[model samples]
Target chain A: MAAAAHEPEVIRDKAVMRAWSRCRRAEGKAVALVPTMGFLHDGHLSLVSAAVAAAAGPVAVVVSIYVNPSQFAPTEDLATYPSDFAGDLRKLAATGAVAAVFCPPDLYVRGRAGHPAAGASGGAVSCLEDAGGHAHETWIRVEQLEKGLCGSSRPVFFRGVATVVSKLFNIVEPDIAVFGKKDYQQWRVICRMVRDLDFAIEIVGTEIVREADGLAMSSRNVHLSCEEREKALSISRSLMNARTAVLNGNNHGQQLKDEIVQTLKEAGGQVDYVEFQSLTFSLD
Target chain B: MAAAAHEPEVIRDKAVMRAWSRCRRAEGKAVALVPTMGFLHDGHLSLVSAAVAAAAGPVAVVVSIYVNPSQFAPTEDLATYPSDFAGDLRKLAATGAVAAVFCPPDLYVRGRAGHPAAGASGGAVSCLEDAGGHAHETWIRVEQLEKGLCGSSRPVFFRGVATVVSKLFNIVEPDIAVFGKKDYQQWRVICRMVRDLDFAIEIVGTEIVREADGLAMSSRNVHLSCEEREKALSISRSLMNARTAVLNGNNHGQQLKDEIVQTLKEAGGQVDYVEFQSLTFSLD
Candidate 1:
């Protein structure tokens, strides 16, 4: 209860974060970690609220704000991923839900202790380059879960996600963790990874948060031109239409996807993928 | 310390080991982990003693006994690898220097919670196959370090070692880890992995242990025939000669290797490799 009202601690280094978290854990506090690429939209904040609701018995909610470079392709928006560290902290502080904020400066740029053999270049290699690029050696993958859907279009996406999440889990050592179902496939990938790796942490998947216009909240939405933004609305709108149709006894899977695709295509949207499955995505 | 006098606890599950280690860590007790495949030898016990000697201020020493199959090549000796669980426990008990033994049944099998998408196979496939061999998608590699020495002959060796050790680090949550220099390349690979990954633990490399006959003690030594074992002694004999040559100021790298190669050749021993480098082996 004190943590909810207390001003959340701002931690920049992983070492400080670990010491803080470990101390709280020793006090029998149940910690829930919310990992985010920050630029606090309503979506990220809603995840915090979900963590709060899920928190029980001396719970401390911690949110990590990191724009992981490994997750973005060189041509993709690595340079453009939004950030406002002061703004994020202010918003998190306003919520009165977070107990601590973990904002590591260089999550991907590992230690500068260059391999003496690497000479001038050191061991600081780009993680995504050829095998010789970076010295980073560990990765976690949920094979089947990362294969379908956005996986095909963004091949390196889930590998980057899983690797970073695994590091976060190791760094934070939280008892419970929260992720958004908006990135539905990612949620499944993470859940499967946690289960397979025996991480001993509970994973909570929060529902998607949307604006009054029914568009899902995302930091990237801010960069869209007005016309492009209107067209982007079709993406979420199509999902809503399919859900309504299914609720109205339209149990035909192919027919539902066909209708949604048509609506998105009319709005000049490219439907990358559409999938429906049981919540857990159990392979058996 | 009380830990040094008490009989070492034998832990078979990952969950229990984590909780036990976490509790001690929270109490400010440092933990030193030594991971090994079972069938303990004096070399293994020496690793334990190093861990004990290095542990400071309420130390807990943990040794994980798991024969990781993923590290062995299919044609190599996975089935023939030695195991004596009871004998290993007895040896560790005799040391009175170990606090716990973590012997998991399946270090690489992962969870049986099969994914539904993999058709009939689910996630039950073996960890080492072609690209589509199994559903396990995680791996750790120390590119430059794994390239030389036995790594060239045994390509999958370092990958398997890095992965399983990473898992053990996550599971045991030790403060310090000790490795043997007898596994010279393996030691370097692990050091690079820990540094590159920012594991937040100290790695101590212990001196290589040898028998009175100058044979390096290994679990696999049990499989050698008497004549074969006698020839094996030549391997160490050449190494001791090489060391003496270097110490006696034989600075010519090529000349020393040429002489050593001829010695092993005369003894009817096929030398796998001979590497001389600065300790770090940076490939700049």
Candidate 2:
């Protein structure tokens, strides 16, 4: 409601975003940046809404819709990543409090207008071969948080995520940023990185949005077959079962994870990993 | 010579430094930061001088003297690392142009006054164990540059270096920062990090200053035995020989490396590694 009357500005350049954020900062206004890999869903809208709620008044909500390449492994879904810019902007606008949508083509690559980093801007994107031949090599990592959970399977995942998020924080200089709890580990990683680096940015975690049947909303959810989608319900059901078990005083982590693994297995689902980090979102 | 008339201020508080920098920014004054691990040798003084030279008109030169903990491994010399705070300050004062000397006891460790970052300032150093039990876990890494050279041997070395350097940059916000080329690989890593991260600070590399005998100046040079010191000269001599071989168009890489290894071996030095990467300081 604080930003209800504000019209959202669509920005493509990092300099423009910075200048915009700077103007907001000079006006003593708080800026909240919601960084997403696009393909927006109800879950992303929830995060954008949370970003809006994080500040009292004079808030600038900028949602970045760049598909960060660094977070994906060479063999992962980067090439197959989904995008619907028109829909994403429409959803962002529906949030009412959103003030800007940053849809840079590239945010972390050596080529394109994405962030104009990697190589100096104004140079042709094709000059990557002449401008040192590989993607930008700097990385930011939260060693402890990235060590467990999804990090064990995808070693480069958190590194890429942390680096790009760091770049965004630098570019926007946001007063607050929001991440969905569905990405519990990633949310924690971002929070720890911000605290450790003394960025003076507050990281807020928005609750996960779920389907009516309790399937956690994800862009990757589009990849599941109809039968696989049915099987996926077991994953959520297992978490709910674990929560119920914990409520009944079954605090043993290994036992809870074993139960979840067995439940998923019985439901015709394959578990890539079943880790229990902290009783925190190690559960999520 | 411009700094000759200005007395340096010793600031331990990050807030004070930021306020001072903000004041400088308002006055259109340029600032140069010289980051050092501070056993303050003539080499570090040269870096300070270079930082001073990098800026024109009104300039503020800041030299950070904290011995960063993240850069040292557990088995490395962190515990026994030498510190001569009084002597270091004397040398920093001798630089004449330095506007501030930031010598926090702990920068990467959450426990010490090292920037008083993790918790609010004016708190006792004892707050670390109670505040947070572990060392800071966030790291900044240069993917390509850190893969070779000293990095191959000390895997965690550059991550620690990069993270601490990044923290320093954020804390000081200097207009220009200087790295000495005695550490050519590290210099490159810092340059790449600054460029890739979109840090507006200008990164300048000062020429390596060496002793009359040609051994590069280093804080660790104090730890070498007389016999080992002479043996180390073979390492430099071998490099000079390899340079001559390259200039003579004997471009066989292995032959040149073997020549250096053999020369060091003959001089009672053990070669830990021999590598060639982009003609950079892959040997460092």
Candidate 3:
């Protein structure tokens, strides 16, 4: 299929989603979803490509472009996160994505209840509400996968991801959903969630898309200064170097992790975490 | 719409559900879900009735007939719980339900990879696994709501209810889901969950169906001896008396709660708990 050029229309209402789902059902087409927080990069596009390839007929790629406030930590950069609807639309159009972009902030964040009138618009704003009288704070916990790496640093991160992804899964009712392997643990956690929850959707993990110099493509990549951009390449490079060492008969898991940590530390990046485990994890 | 008496076709696969959903979509029917552990009682029937009334068009009443082992406390009954599928189907048939009974063993449980024999059925046979390759024993935590009443006594209870309800929500995708008010705290927790998670489905709290002598109907009521059955009626009587007192300008929450506890204590039944919160609580 040739990719379209113009921006796709955006849809916000649940009634519209149900109507769209009905239309797709009549056409005997299976829907596919690629959920993102909408600072669309090549990595997200790779996931979209995977979803398209896996689906049977005219694929409805429901790109949920919401920066969920619940996922961010108190000190995390939720307020400064970048979003570009026009640019994101242009990229999705080029990918020949069928149907509209689901760019509903209030719908995605607050559900049927409209977004609270906080009176801040057109720029970065804090979406945190006081814990008082806010009834629903229950979270989905993915036991082992959420205890290490990014999870240790950002505690409530995966809870927010699980909840929002769940909402998207219900809203889109996708046959297949895609995730980037760059967020390795996140992908694994979601896979476990789908299996545990018995969601019929297939989860496809795509390899991380990288810049020419091997820095992982991220919306947060924009936050880094030029010097930090160069420094971040060391993360992927260090992983590569560690892989080589393990392949050369260095089979000790702790030693491999330490080597990766040391290599990253030498490259002038603060180490978040480096751990290794058997890759035999599967969706049964 | 006239309620008919007929056996609804049972569907177990995703393809069948897709076809059914598509057919319903074509007919523009709204579905209502009534989730239960399936030892059919008057309370459960009341929920089915509520679902039938709330749904528009050809209402699909999905009665999940699994005795969800996850929700039961180890000290409580998990092994010898009553299950009568053939009888339950007959009861559902009487409701004129276009219901699909999802009866899968380990079908919803996530099993260990490479261990195909693990979690093979949806019954009491599967072991819950965490990421660490160890057994998962943790339960869902619903901060303050779980502190009083049943939560304090049955620690793992609401977690099991929440998780299983979440699974049911995904599987059924109902427009409105019904729950009996017999388990008042369970209904409250589920309402909190739907509100917190931003689920698009409506949660309807059906009034507690009772016997002629004011005994709340329950599957467990079958386990109670004739003497225990007599003792159970006192709990409901106390609740009604408390309600009457509150209606007569008694605003003191603690005093009302204490009265109910004293009444239950005077009778033969053990007092689990009695709580009074603001009227803001509803199945939103």
Candidate 4:
């Protein structure tokens, strides 16, 4: 725990990161992973602490800070996504929980070794064709879980998330991984993925960290004006109200979803969707 | 070489297989993998031998024998696929190359721990939902490479191949994997997948193993009648003719394909497809 306060090593190469994890594993030490985009916030740090606490024995924590391009669509904020490499490092260092920062500039390096463009720096091309007419064509998908939520609007979102996470799991080779439940579907999709793929690592889902004023902490919160931020509060409020309603014996899923959608619309929020899938849905 | 002649230990559990490979790795030994769908022929043995020859140092060769159900469709011959586990083991033992055989009855268990069906033995459900309403939803796809050849006819084939192979790689943690070029498109798809996914393992594609009559060795060959077997000879002959034509100044891709198709048709062989993809296509 004392070594956790030191400056974390920033690993830019995939091989180096993998070797670091492998070395830790070889030493009979557990490696905990917290995957994130660069602009680290309290929610991200909470996931890091969650990873640290979740480890049973002495553990080496790795925080991957790549802003994965595969998880973003062309129309999305991929180009405009906020980043602060230096600030992120300082934040992680402040957490006193992280051991290393795996800030690989590009995880999706095209055509490494086998293809025609083997050594060329074909960096971070999405699942689509790169400028060189070549592409990183392999993708991982969680078919059933990825559907209905964000998958409906962002057709390529879950595929991107699943693929990049698979890359991280393979490279980091962590004993356990932590994900924030703010992105509920993503966390479930990943849990399903690790299970289906037979990844030996355990998946830890942590609760979403929210601001004192009740808004969930997100990097995109920086983009919102005060008025927009106030309007976004309705999302958490409606969810709390729905929970209260469910506790009060109003157990209809569709009715709660309709109420939440109406609440968001009334609060001047543009509601893309409001879905409720039963967590207790029996597989049997 | 003495270790090679010892009977290969059969491994069925995923955890045990991972432990076997990890222990070998910890001892500074390389583990090579040869994946097959049972009913092993000389072709599969050749691949096991190639894995032995490919290693620079002492290596533990692992062969996985599973008839993956995800790659086959409901309309396809999933149930009818040939399998001979006992015979396959004898053939591999005779080769004196394989160190271990990973023959898991099912890799796609519906849920291990996170799902409602945890520890329920919901075995080997394809991408589709099972009778218990649970499924293994995760899948891997080599998009561009899988598009043209067998992918065209069997839409789910390469995704199945890519996904299952990924499971094997994660479980076996092999230093290198040997794939036979008899499934030419499959080999290419897997190579592309390993490159794109940043898997540390190496993929070695071995040449197609042919019988004395020049027919590619396949498990399905047992189903062929004498006349059907004679007609199948046209496939390898046409490929040889096309190669000869290419060497003799017939560099036109489509022209060679047309000639091959014509030859197969003339020999009363029903041609599903005859096409060419230039392996030398420059990514630049």
Among these predicted structures, which one has the highest DockQ? 4
User: Candidate 1: TM of chain A?
Assistant: 0.87
TM-score of each: 0.86, 0.77, 0.84, 0.89
Off by over 4 Å in 4: A1-5, A110-134, A252-255, A279-284, B1-5, B110-134, B252-255, B279-284
What is the lDDT, from 0 to 100, of the residue B260 in candidate 4?
Answer: 89
User: Across residues A185-259, which tens digit of lDDT does each residue of candidate 3 receive?
Assistant: 889888988876657689989998889998889999988999888878778888888778767866666666777
Per-residue lDDT over B1-284 for candidate 1, one digit per residue giving the tens place of the 0 to 100 score: 46456578988888899999988787778989999998999999889888877876778899999888667766687878899988998889888778899998876543334342232112222235422335555555566677778977777788778878888887898999999999999998998777666677899999888889999999999998998888888878887887897778767777767777887788787778777767224311
| Order of the predicted models by DockQ, top scorer first | 4, 2, 1, 3
State which candidate has the highest lDDT.
Answer: 4
Task: Rate residue B41 of model 4 by lDDT.
Answer: 90
Give the Å error, residue A266, model 1.
2.3
Candidate 2: lDDT of A68?
Answer: 77
Q: Over the stretch B203-265, how does candidate 3's per-residue lDDT look in tens digits?
A: 999887888999877787888898878878888898889788768866667777777888788
Per-residue lDDT for B1-284 in model 2, tens only? 46454456778877677778767766778888898877878888998888877787778888888876556555577656667878887777776777788766566445344332332111112222233455576767676687667876666677667887888877787789999887778998998898778776799998878888879888888889998899889977898889887888777888789989999899987678877657534332
Any residue pairs clashing in model 4, and if so which?
A: none
Distance from true position, residue A188, model 1, in Å? Answer: 2.1
lDDT string for model 2 (A54-149, tens) is 888878889998887667655577778888888887777776878888777666546334433332111212222233446676767676677767
Candidate 4, A274: how far from true, in Å?
A: 2.2
Candidate 2 ranges with C-alpha deviation above 4 Å:
A1-5, A109-133, A222-238, A241-245, A248-267, A273-277, A280-284, B1-5, B13-23, B73-81, B109-134, B212-215, B223-284
Ranking by TM-score: 4, 1, 3, 2
lDDT of 4 by residue, B184-231 (tens): 899999988898888888899889889999999999999899999999
Clashing pairs in 3: A136-B196, B105-B121, B105-B122, B105-B123, B106-B121, B106-B122
Sequence-dependent TM-score of model 1:
0.86
